[model samples]
Target chain A: MKQSALLDHPFGARYAAALPAADAARQDARETLALEGLPGPKREEWRFTPLRGLAKIPFIPAASADDIDVCDLPADVPRFTDAHRIVLVNGVYRADLSDTASETGLTVTEAKTPDHGVDAPLAVLNAAYMSGGVTISVRGVVAKPVHLVSIGAAGAEPAAFHPRLAIAVAPAAKLTILETHHGLPGQPYFSNPVTTISVGTAGVLRRYVLVREDSEAFHLATTVADVAADAKFDAFHLGLGGALVRQEISVDFVGEGAAVRLNGAYALMGRAHHDFTTFMNHDMPNCTSSQVFKGVVDGESRGVYQGRVLVARHAQKTDGQQLHKALFLSRGPQIDCKPELEIYADDVKCAHGATTGELDPDHLFYLAARGIDPQAARLLLVQGFLADALENVDDAVVRDILSGEISGWLMRKASA
Target chain B: MALLEIKNLHVSVGGKKILNGISLALNAGEVHAIMGPNGTGKSTLSNVIAGRDGYDVTEGQVLLDGQDILAMEADERARAGVFLAFQYPVEIPGVTTSAFLKTAINAKRRAEGKPEIDAMEFLKLVKAKQKLLSMPDDMIKRALNVGFSGGEKKRAEVLQMTLLEPRVAILDETDSGLDIDALKIVSEGVNTLRGPDRTFLIITHYQRLLNYIVPDHVHVLVGGRVVASGGKELAEQLEAEGYARYLSAA
Candidate 1:
């Protein structure tokens, strides 16, 4: 595809033409794509991020199908025991590869129309050509976790994959979902995915996303949540991989008495980069939202966090808090954090803070004096820095897995 | 044999002379009290002996059992069985007291080619030491010196010294922020650790602590050097007459 053809509009013709016909939400997707042009380093959000490499890639529709071998998952791998397992292979849903349906409270089908409103080009791209997006509906309270694994298969040729997912929590329902991403080695691909979540009245939904992809991969994902009255949404994100990764989370309190807690930890090393941008909109009264993001960057890595809490005029009694802290290990690494609170309501308590610093030298000295090697001292301090975020995870099993992954990543990076 | 010997030590901080040509020798099983007024570099002497950074040792040599200790780093000095009970203990948050002490003890052990103690064994050691000091069990689990009272912090210093079992223990004003009861408890803990193979150097301004932990030798430090060295009677004389006459003569 010619560069001009891709630049003619926000949603390139190649992207629109490559979208499958089965995706019925293409119109809303296209409108969302009209929001912005291709991002460059000049853009404020893309300042520290190097977009030149992305701009150089030719725009082409991902090939229809390719042969991809599936690796055997570990025996102790986390799986949603009660809910149905949905597997998306190379941005296309493969029903034959997933487990059979088992429960009545959970149902997975293709989205007929996008219910959650999103006005971003990335969202449009995900909605437009989304190959096998999953639409999950939980009717009532459910006692199991839903495991959604996105597996990116290495094709004979390089391509881009966009996956879309929608989750709806019915009234008085409770559900926990673990969404994970797995990519094949030597597969140089871009994953632009979007997930929409709706929490009904008196419902509770806990979502966790664990992203560990090939080091050369590009991941751009956005999660949009719409909460109802007296609903609770607990979301945790763990970012440990990817050459360049950006996850944007936007939440809207459309009903009164809704509460949301957003906690995340990102541990990056080498030349890897990660960005977390969040926006919480309060449109009703008596709502609360809290967000905390902690990151550890070593080597030449970089981390970025931008969070904003918006309180509408009529949304009185809104309580919101946002905190972002990062530890930069090496002098070459950097962290950029911007936390904003925009409140139009008169009676509201909103606070935000951002801090970036190196590891405590005294603490390191003390640890080293205790006979721990310098590298082990660093690992302990990093673990301490990320302890608060990990504490927010309710499941012990999941917390252990996450902690092991972080420690393993650190060890690997140190060894390299 | 001398356990710790400081030969003509001259030290300065921020270009100001603190310890000028001060010399002291501490033999095993000896408890030597070095009494001086404020600004006389008593704390500086202890810090210099402990190898704390930011202090310039212009001309001096600290020998721990005849080894050049002034060239060692603070941790190296610590591993070499030199412990300094600070006048003001630093508060380290997020690190438990028991954890810190265990790490220190293990470090010392590793330096001596000894195997590390198991968790249960270490816990037993902590229990014994806590009981000896009459400290609450919760103090061990709390963050190191964080939110600890003055006396509690002093007791913690003593507890750490007992656990580490250093060859030369330098108590830098351990009695400064302690009550009569706490002082007695701390002195008892120190007294229990006293042996022919260990040396104690207690830095203080008052002789009250000496009443509990009797010093075998007393040194009156004036103008950063020992101006008067005598038996334990020196402490009583200074307690009764004060250092006013000595300061004027020096």
Candidate 2:
């Protein structure tokens, strides 16, 4: 591994020079990134989603771009009633636009450079150039949800930003967080976000993420969560817009009787590409994990879902289930699905299924016979297909918000 | 002129002839029952009239209110007042029954230059219609026909027919999966919708359904063409003797 790998890429010396003085952790991450560069097609995890197109772009540090400014929340951003607002522009927190009011049992502070031993390429990239983010801690039942909105903008030239977020729930505590990633349209910008979460024993955490970046922008996010005994972690990720986007989530069950429900849905059109990669590590006995992912692709777009569940030899009574279903609106779109289940325990129950199909003609004809036009019929069917995954989101408000985003995407595709 | 007319219609599936020059005409305020044995193109007639794909008209004219409707697409024909009560209605998951009903009603209304149905008004209308069919109030909140029983699916079809109020309504094998009670309930639903402006084309293999709805005319179809036509008594005669005579004649 030579330093030329990083030098040849956009995030070499120039990106490092613009960043703040680094600590030992950041320096170690930068040296690792310089050694490995970005994951390429040879890496099995990155095979489906190649970063060649992303690496070719000469992107400057988003912090160095002084022309970009976001003074207010975007008009299209849905206002979640009673939820605390947290706004981030170009990866940096905006105090003026955010709601800094503190609530009981909940704390929010500027995220520090913590040594999270994550070796993934993108996670390393996030650590190497991490600019701004927040750390939210829950000590007791937090009644109100926290809404974190990340906004990205590039002026004159392509800009890149990396944000780090950490969340910790104390024993027997509960919390819910919603993340919405959006950006302005101009020169293509790149957003790299890494989130680390920990749920204490007997605790509960519900995290919902929605990504609708500009069509010309690039977004790659990674989330790692650890669940303790008798804890529950429910999460849903939705991807609707972006030229290229990938959401990777990894969950590690560290105690018995823990439960995790990870579900996601994506709707893509044009040349947009979206990918979801998940890893479930069942290291403790009596832990259960389930993943239901569904997506709809149109135009020349591409959708990918790669999920791996590993059960340790001692982790008996592990229950893991994963299913991926994709619908293609036309002949041009492509779907790649890979589901891997490794059960070293003899008493584990693990099942995985993947399916790709077009809209059922009978369904279309049924709607058509009822006077619904072909376009509207298609839209209804697509929404119905993705609704299976959306139903997994237990929170009604969050479900409706994601549904609205998917509906918006469908309407845009219908007109296009 | 007849409210719905089928004149010298010929249809084929996979280049194989199914309906061989079959024709029928239903005047305003009339229920015409087409009784035939299996493989006699009974379903084909209903599908062709409702504009289903994979069927080659080859040669035919299906007219609604004196206009040839074979040129219109399925949805266009539906908006132009054509409805088909499918024997096996498709099960569409995740599409709530209420949402589907509203979309259909709105489509018809939009085509007629009327405003869309408001949420409250739509719910009220569906509730009223559901009561007429003895449907549970929460049925509309479930996915469209996804988990419905056979009887419930048939009743839902009648509910749609009642809502859309099409000029020409075709019921294909609507009695196949219904029990006696469901049949009576479904027939009553059809009876309530029969009026001077509407005509019904009931396509069934058995004459049991006619006992409730009481068609004005009954035609015996065999081997893709009508072998005989007569008054309502024709249905009773077939019910007693079966379609052995018609099959031999064809």
Candidate 3:
């Protein structure tokens, strides 16, 4: 049978016909069409993550606008009043639920086609039938941060949702954006999201993402950020709770004097799985970037971190450092980390390192010898290991919120 | 009654005897110094008393304050008020000294069914002890002994010892890397904690530390055994004459 016919069987024929025109990208997608169920052990990245439920769940596009209810923001959730807020419910942007205005130098529109070299099948699928996605642009410098909130609500039936967002920061402009993923109670769904961000010359942008999904939920997201000359981008990611999640971030430094700092922390327990994959490309000179990611895995959980820094020949003086470390709290738990640096320029300073091990026995002994219980000692050591990455977050309120969330998660895991 | 009593202790590491038939008794309000050469099993005796793992107590009974401590784990023994000032304190990165000390103190307190100490109370206690040890406030704020000078590390160990307030403290060559000033400061800290309820075992290679903290009893450890025991005068004799005679005899 032809590849298109296989994709047509589960997801309608029309969806399969909308595959990307890029032959190589489509071929790669087609070859994996037989993966009707979750990407299993056969897939390299999904080897540690369980996804059988995601593969077996029938694929259904988001329901009509009236079928989804948009509730008021929970009191516990922080709000940015001055900034424009765009809310997406179950992969569909709800205009009635959002407070965005096109006249405010920001526009929210549905993308007709995957524009600007987005040839991946997932991107094409998001483009072909995506319901609600906003195109946010700051014509000039904007004083306020733009908040984009995407939420996945559980429906009565097994469902899947794909949310797409395209962002463009104009020259010399600054933007701070916050994105959160929340699963409604009884909402068992699969969320596959793709966001593309472009920073113009001398622009600055800070993006904070918090992912707290239900344990039964499956989340797959990819973020592509491109930086122009003299631009700076900082991103902080916190993965607190997820059944199985893989977040991939790719940043391309296309112009000289551009800089980026990527920091993330993942605290997971139970049978949950969380993976973070980052790829940084330095194509211009005098560009700098650093990434510090730490994870704490307990119970039967698993964590994976794969980071790569690529420096081209012309990308000289590209100071890049990547460090990934993980602490395994239980013998049944495991963490796999791979940090790689491929440098082609002699003048560039690039280094990468990865370490995965259990908590230090000596530190534990030291704590215990001081009269602390074994459980509390483990918690303290885990917190110390994650402190460096947590301190990297510049916003105090956000940092406090993230820390509290992580502590709560850990406490619950310890009790459970 | 003695606060700590070791009877016929025989400890071996990796199938080699390090402490053979060693015995000692420590009474409250008393300091006993054990002076010996480098390979005289001074450290092994301290470690064995602290219940360090992998040290096979082939034949021995370690009693702390009338309780058999050899059967307890390291932490249990610590809670029972036995502390070992490590010769080389382990450096823990990313953990502040103050936070570590507070956690340790509270851990012990909590294990004893006591309420946790408040933040202000902890700060007050730390400040008072810092003044006693003449340690800078920054030393407590920095990562646990990370990037600290050798003398600073030794001072930090003394600081912990003062805060934990163990009933029987064993200083295992803590003066090895200290200068005269640091040695005096550390000894002063130990002296301040000295009381009728507390005892100490100072283990060192030279009698230099003995000058600062005079011991009531001095024992010459040779060939994994206490070859000679005498009053404080024994330390002076060993200091005037070196370990040359003892080394040759062993």
Tell me the number of clashing residue pairs for each predicted model. Answer: 1, 0, 4
Query: Among these predicted structures, which one has the highest DockQ?
Result: 2
* The candidate that achieves the highest TM-score relative to the unseen native structure: 2
Q: Rank the candidates by DockQ, best first.
A: 2, 3, 1
- Poorly placed runs, candidate 2 (over 4 Å): A1-7
Lowest lDDT block of 10, candidate 1 chain B:
B90-99
Error of 2 at A392 (Å): 1.1
Off by over 4 Å in 1: A1-24, A27-37, A58-65, A74-115, A133-141, A144-153, A368-375, B35-38, B86-106, B115-160, B173-189, B204-214, B218-223, B227-250
- lDDT for A195 in candidate 1 is 89
Q: Write the per-residue lDDT of candidate 3 for residues A74-184, one digit (tens) a residue.
A: 444546666677777776776776786544555557654345445434454444444446677766666566666677766566556666778888888877777777676
Candidate 1 docking quality: incorrect, acceptable, medium or high: acceptable
For candidate 3, report its TM-score.
0.87
Whole-model lDDT, model 2: 0.91
How far off is residue A332 in model 2, in Å? 1.2
What TM-score does chain B alone reach in each candidate, compared with the true chain B? Answer: 0.98, 0.99, 0.97
Worst 10 residues of 2 chain A by lDDT: A1-10
Q: Which lDDT values do the candidates have, in the order given?
A: 0.80, 0.91, 0.78
